[model samples]
Target: MPAPERLLPYWTIAVPPLALTVHFLLHSSAGPAAAAVLVAALLGAVLSAVHHAEVVARRVGEPFGAVLLALAVTVIELGLIVSIMFGGQPEPTLLRDTIHATVVLVLHGVAGLCIVVGAIRHREQDFSTRGAQAYLTVLLPMVALTLVLPNFTTSLPGPYYTATQLAFVSASCLVLWLAFTFVQTVRHREYFLPLPATTADEAPSPAAVAPARPPGRQSLAALALLLLALAAVVLLAKDVSPYLQSLVTKAGAPAALVGVIVAAIVLMPEGMTAVRAAKKNQLQTSINLALGSGVASIGLTVPAVSLVAWWTHTPVALGVTPGGAVLLGLSFLMAILTYGNGRASLLSGVVHLILLATWLFLIVVP
Candidate 1:
């Protein structure tokens, strides 16, 4: 087996609580310079969160590790959003904007960055085409049922679904994600595993790469730290939301940009981990991380939000605007072609990045 995992950095142990304290007690009253420091601490927490998560993931194993990290972050984010929604009059379009931004971020930004990083380093990278396809297949339907279908439904006027229709859609997303998880971790586990590199320079031997898991005690420690970091992250992001909204408002940017900022902050750890995996030529693992984040964002967030909205008698919107639908359509179509061949190149990465840029530009111009 490869060398045992590295020692846990001290910052990893300290940043979470520091961020939590700063977010809760001091953030609002801080001056501009202090605010910058707080933002730095926030970013430090994100980096440390990824470090602890990687420790836990290595202790666990491939796709399962990714799933654990994704699910943990999503669950926390879902709780934060729900708590905020229940705290006051919730925005009807909050769920839609957040979910749409997540999908867009993953499909284009995260995946494209991974591809570009890996391809630039190694000329091209290979992953399990089946695995990529599987992610896309499940993602398409979930997006359609939750985002697109609501636009056309007549049971309720506008983009709002009737009670029965909402329940059906939520159930459908949950079921689809569960089935995809089963296939990913159990039935076709190999599909998500990293493909062997053809050259020694590209990848070390399997044993060299798969280091022995940390001892039981270390594993437990890592798990605890992971939870702590994630908890702190959610709180910090929630605190940042109002400030972010204010900035966007001052700039006269679209309201949707606020959701994108929230989603991006929430996803920073996962995106960082995925990009690192790509830099190491571990494209399969990166794809698993990127696509897995997308799948979990919708599959988990929708049902949780739906239940809360239903219980609170809160109105929620699920449908995207025509501009959003076009972006979604283009993103999915590009995903199909990108993963269709099991190979990724610099060109593919650049194309996807352009699409993401188009998305950001449209948000401002449209």
Candidate 2:
């Protein structure tokens, strides 16, 4: 078997960053725009990771560090994507569809499988059957008001108004997503709920700690280097957006593709972690991280962009297409199914994968 130490390097350095780089390059358009995005994404991903470490360190007592980190990354990722949308090149409906697509994939597809897998492994794990249902409560209304209604508009003033509607919708999304994060991270924080209670006489599980370093200078040096790398990534993303926009225009891909592409990039790190956790039979953590990240992405990104668009008078689309609405409905329903039971199985995993495929089909097709 491969040594755990060897695997650690992959998580800490190799994989998360490698994915970001490839995403930049593959999506880059030829010329200055491509170069700019490459630089910005690289810098952004690094800074984004550092910000994650800072968030984890600051919010130490939060139930899941990984989930919190995923939220943080989504914020940065959305920040870049939304900023790009402001420049001419992206589809008007890109923001709305992207947010919708991300929520579906993360909450239902990734989260559902995590729960199912966890349950299958532990058998005793609780899926919080009732709590999972809350997804339906929130998601249905969100989809209806924002996505579904737009398709039926018969007398809209113009495409400009459609863009304005998207901005408002983005704002709403940001608020909802962030509110959920606050609740999860700060208010209704996770306790050792599923873990068996320890008797007074029993020893507690030992918390993992870092080994002492030789000097404070080394720590500072590491921090500085990390910050520097992060700056580069953001700068790269700035340029990357134009290239991607050009590619989209050139290829005539659907609006939803932007969301999937961005979400996949944002999700790279947490997705790997979730898969690894499932393999280790740590399904609850995986479920929490994956689902939690999806929720956070919605709550946070929508608001952030909404505020910007409102301020700048840039238009964004908030409506979900009929097709997207159906997928969203199914995705939420599945999330309830996967997490409500507090257990998991390969069956649930397959279900989520199906949902993921459905999303891909929706985005790639006309």
Candidate 3:
């Protein structure tokens, strides 16, 4: 199909919200399970939009376009999720755990799957194994400390978890996210560097790297837009969440619906990137972006939301439940093994699928 035709298919963005509307009208009330599905579909649409933008950027050979698209989606997705979170009865620690989950999914699962698939398909190791290893090493300890351990103990609020404790966790996650982003930024710089005066191929010089913007201007712009977007999402969520949460509380829906819905909303854009990359044979970059976004989502999104909760004096839950912790640990381990060697195999892909299935099962079973 032509590019024009491809663009038309992206209209699927309309599906998610429409589905939510239909759900609202028909049921006049929906449960968490339904809500979760709706949210996931919505997020998937968002992810698809980002992936499409990246495709256009790739065709045009414009990295800036990709960066802009990523920035836009990141802001939008975070805005929507945070808004919904605040709209509901406050789950302070929820933001932290969700962020942790997103990181785990990205670092170990999505990255591992991409590497494994790409390696197998290309019949060669053509990607960055070291990057994957470094990511997992840092990710595992951080998650174990911040998420898994906290779930089992209730000493979190006053003693083991104080104002300082929360700040440390939130800041640590953000720093980790920044560290990963730095890696990508550095790699992009390296790629754009001068090939040296001795190079034989005569070609026009690649465009000069843009001058750095002042930190103040960038920070102010980010803060303003983020505030604006978050406010908008919060308004929408306030209208939506009470009804949704009530439905769940009243036993009209399953309890596990919350996680599913939250996952869908955040993971939407990511799924789009993955399928598109697989089709394009650019699976490595796709994996990198998908997993990268996931990590960013967990690391960045949680802290930002948690800070909001803190300001509002809401409860924040950063740790996974005992069962959830176990599943997450196993998932992380499998992901590390799959992507550790920088090579992928069909079997590795199957392992990730299995892990996802396990996650779903755990969420659904009481």
Candidate 4:
């Protein structure tokens, strides 16, 4: 047999199962200590997921690699939302909140952090402008259609689409998603490739990225572990759903915060990976993950959500407040400039971050 790829780290191999075990142990419990353990395990599994995903990404290479990771992460996120929605009381706003949170967090928060970290390390970073443009091209329209259009449509009352409208919107998003995926992975894969860095400073930092995947079994092991990690992450997140609600209530936070927290936890590890890629001067890779996740979150999510909500007779509200619309518009405009510019710097990153902070603050205080 071919030599086994690099032996797997014990933690990467162990965390997912262990987290699942903890989830079973504490899933029904109601208390602080249990919540703490579950949260810790959840985080461990996230890190483990990232490690396995990176290995697979290395094995697969380029935009397809990015697509795999993004799809996996978004699937886990969608699973969490579905499980929670069906497992308990109706949460009509959950889908909207989660999708919105995913877009806002990925587009501004993760992307911003990547630029900041990369710029701080190298002072300048180069990535494929076309790649960024491609992501926004799909993402912007879908956002407007699903998140914004609902508010204005006369076919339904405030903030909803009639079944016909929902069906149309869902189909439209899926088409956009399918077309973008095909383009990114097949027709123009080079758009997502890491551009050749223009300066010596743009080189990968010594510790920025893990070494290449070993040839034989490591990739296979990673693929298996990635699946395991994703399951653990999704289930454990659902198990923690009660705590999120209770925590939000105790804090006197808005109901929407539950979605934000869920999105935050799910995206945190993935965002870290993107930041690391940026620090390595692989800004295109970071962009792929950021925008890819943003697009996939909406494209894949809305369709699945609409179908399920229809079957179960669940209500989904997909409109944003005026403030939310303004923030989203600003965010899109910022994303456009960031992606269109070809060069990334500290200032652009800071701007994106500011938009994120403003959204968060307004949500809390408004």
RMSD of 4: 3.0
Task: Write the residue-wise lDDT of candidate 3 on 4-89 in tens digits.
Answer: 34442434434434444543453344566655654444444444445444443443333454455445555655655565566646
How do the residues 1-366 of candidate 1 rate in per-residue lDDT, one tens digit apiece? 223336476777778888878877855664566556656766776667767777787778865776676677676567456644544434577788888998999999999999999988988888899999999999999999888888898878758898888888889888888889889978998888888768767666766467666677777877887787777766665555555555778899987776787578667888887999899888898888888888888888888889888898888888999888988999999999999999999999999999999998988998
lDDT by residue for model 2 (14-91), tens: 434553555655554567655654645554455446443543333343445534454556555665676577766645
Ranking the candidates on lDDT from highest down gives 4, 1, 2, 3
In angstroms, how far off is 242's CA in candidate 1?
Answer: 1.9
Task: Report lDDT (CA) for all predictions.
Answer: 0.80, 0.57, 0.54, 0.82
Q: On a 0 to 100 scale, what is the lDDT of residue 89 in model 4?
A: 48
lDDT of 2 at 238: 60
Relative to the true structure, candidate 1 has a C-alpha RMSD (angstroms) of 2.7
Write candidate 4's Cα lDDT for 1-366 as tens digits. Answer: 332433467888989889888988888887799999988988888888877887788778765776787677766777668876666645678887887898899888999999999989888888888888998989999999988999999977868888888989999999999899889988998888777656676555543444554565688988888898888888887877777677888899888887787688778876887898887778888888788777888888889889988898877899988888888898888888888879999999999889889889987999
Please tell me which model should have the higher TM-score, number 3 or number 4.
4
lDDT score, candidate 1: 0.80
- Displacement of the residue 6 alpha carbon in candidate 3, Å: 7.9
How high is each candidate's TM-score?
0.90, 0.71, 0.67, 0.90
Quick one: best lDDT, which candidate?
A: 4
Report lDDT (Cα) of residue 329, candidate 4.
91
Clash pairs, model 4 backbone: 5-217
